[model samples]
Target: MSNDFYTSSILPYAAIIVKICRAYTNTQEDFEDYYQEVCLQIWRSRKNFNGQSEWSTWIYRLTLNVCLTLLKKKDRQHVASDYLPDEASEGSHVFADESLNQLYDAIKQLSEVDRGIILLYLEEKSYKEIADIIGSNTNNIGVRIKRIKERLKKLLNGKVN
Candidate 1:
C-alpha cells in the first residue's frame, strides 16, 4: 500500500490500537512498547492480507495475536483497565469506573489464557469471533466466561486468595 493509503486509513486507528494495547499491558512503558510492536506487526502483515475478513477485523486479529503472545511470554502478570471517559476525566470518584477497574484488576490476576478471553469479552467480541482469534472453539467460551466472571466477582468482593 502507498504511504498515503497507510497514513489515511491505518494511522487513524491508532487510538483504538492504543486502547487495546493498554488493556494488554500493565506499565506505561510496556504499553508504548507493545503499541510499537503492534505497528511493526501490522506493517509486516500488511501484504499478507488475503481479504477473507474485513480489513478492520484483520487488524484486530493481528494486534490481538501480538498482545496475547506478549502476555504469554511475560506469564500474564498484569494489564491496565480502561476507564470510562467521564471517570477518566474526573480521576477517581466514579463508582462505575472504580468497579470496572476493580474487575480488571481481578482479571489481571488470572492466567494468561483466561485473561485473554476476558479481555476480548470486555471488548464485546462475540464468542465465535473470539474463538477464531484465540484459536478456541465456541463451546468452550461460555463455560470459561462464566468461570472468569465468577472469579472476577470474588476478587471485587475482596475474597482474595
Candidate 2:
C-alpha cells in the first residue's frame, strides 16, 4: 500500500483496529502482531471494498476477520495465555481505566464470535450494522446480544464458570 493511502485511509481508524486486535490477543507481542496484520490486510483488501457500507463498518469487519483468523491459528498451535499484562506497562492508554480492563477481561472469556458481537455492540454499532458485519439477521443478533450481555454480567460478577 502507498504511504499516502496508509496515512489518509487507515491511520484515522487506527483505534478501531487496536481495539479489535487487543480483544483477540493475550500478550503485548501478540497485540502488536495482530495490529500490524490487520493494517496490512486492510491495505491489501482495499480494492474489495465496494462502498456498500460505511468505511468504518468495512474496517470493523476486516479487522475482526483478520484477528479471528490469527487467533484461530494461534489456538491451534497452543492454548492462549490466561494472564493479562498491565496495559500501562504496554504503553497503551486504551485500557487505562481499571473497570474497563476488568470488562475486557470478562469479554475475553467469551467465545470468539461472541467477542466480536459484544465488541461491536459496545462500540454502539446498530444491531443491523452488527448483523451485517457478522452475517446474521437482526433478530438473531438481538437475541444473541441479550444472551451475551447476561453472560458478561455473570462474568463481571464472578458468577460464571
Candidate 3:
C-alpha cells in the first residue's frame, strides 16, 4: 500500500487496530505481526468495501475478521509458550496499568467469539453494530454481552479458573 493511502486512511484508526490485535495476541511479536497483517489486509481489501457502513465500522469488522483468522491459524500451528518473555512484557506498553493487564488476561481466557464480542462491547459499539460486525442478532449480542460481563467479573474476582 502507498504511504499516502496508509497515512490518510489507516493511520487515523491505528489505535483501533492495536486494541483488536492486542486482544488476540499474547506476545509483542504476535501483536506486531497481527497489526501489520490487519493493515495489509485492509489495504488489499479496500476495493471490496461497498460503502454501506461507516468507514470506522468497516475498519472494526475487517480488523476483527483478520485477527480471528490469524488467531485460528496460529492455534492450528500449535505454537506454545509457557511464559511471557521479559522483552515482550516490557514492550507491551498498552497494558501498562496492572488492572488493564488483568482484564486482558481474563479476556484471553474467553472463547474466541466471546473475545470479539467483549472487545467490541468494551469499545462501546452499540448492540446493533456489534451484531452486524459479529453477524449475530441484536438479542443474541445483548445476551452474550451480559454473560460475558458476568464471566469477566467472576474471573477478576478469582471465582473462576
Candidate 4:
C-alpha cells in the first residue's frame, strides 16, 4: 500500500482496525503483524468495494477475516485465562484496568466467529450492520450476541463450558 493511500484511507479508521487486531492477538508483535496485513489487504482489495456498505464496515470485515485466517494458520490455542503479561505490551495502553484485561482474556477464549460478533457489538454497531459485516442474518446476529454474552460471563467466572 502506498503511503498516501494508507494515510488518507486507513488512518482515519485505524482505531477500529487496532481494536479488532488487539482482540485477536496476544503480543505486540502479533498485533502489529495483523494490523499491517489488514491494511495491505484493504489496499489490495479496494477495487472490489463497490459501496455496498460503509467503508468502515468493509474494513471491519476485512480486518476480522485476516485476523481469523492468521489465527488458524498459527494453530495457537487461546491463552489461559490465568495468563497475564509480565509487562505491558505495545498496545496495552488502550486498556488500563485489570478487569478489562480479564474481560479481554475471556473474550480471546471464544471461537473466532463469536469473537468477531462480540467485538462488533461492543463497538456499538447495529445488528443489521454486524450482520452485513459477518454475512449473517440480523436475527441470527441478535441471538448469537445474547449467547455470546452468556458464554463470556461464564468464561469470566471460570465456568467455561
Count of backbone clashes, every candidate in sequence:
0, 0, 0, 0
lDDT of 2 at 109: 84
- What would the per-residue lDDT of candidate 2 be over residues 1-161, giving only the tens digit for each residue? 88999999999999778878888876677888999899899889999999999998999999999999997787678645633343423445346787877787787888899999999998899999999999999999999999999999999999986
In the predicted model 2, the residue pairs found to clash are: none
Give per-residue CA lDDT, model 3, range 1-161, as digits (tens). Answer: 99999998999999879888888887778889999999999999999999998888899999999999998787677655634333344446456788888888888778888988999898899999999988999999999999999999999999998
Q: On residues 102-154, what C-alpha lDDT tens digit does candidate 1 reach at each position?
A: 65556667776787678778778899877876788998998899998998888
Residue 60 shift from truth in candidate 2, angstroms: 0.8
Give per-model CA RMSD: 6.6, 3.3, 2.9, 4.1
- Give the top-scoring candidate (lDDT): 3
lDDT of 2: 0.85
The per-residue C-alpha lDDT of model 2 at residue 83 equals: 37
TM-score of each: 0.71, 0.87, 0.89, 0.83
lDDT of each: 0.71, 0.85, 0.87, 0.85
**Clashes by residue pair, model 3:** none
Those runs of model 1 whose alpha carbons end farther than 4 Å from true positions after fitting are 1-16, 72-100
- Cα lDDT over the full model 1: 0.71
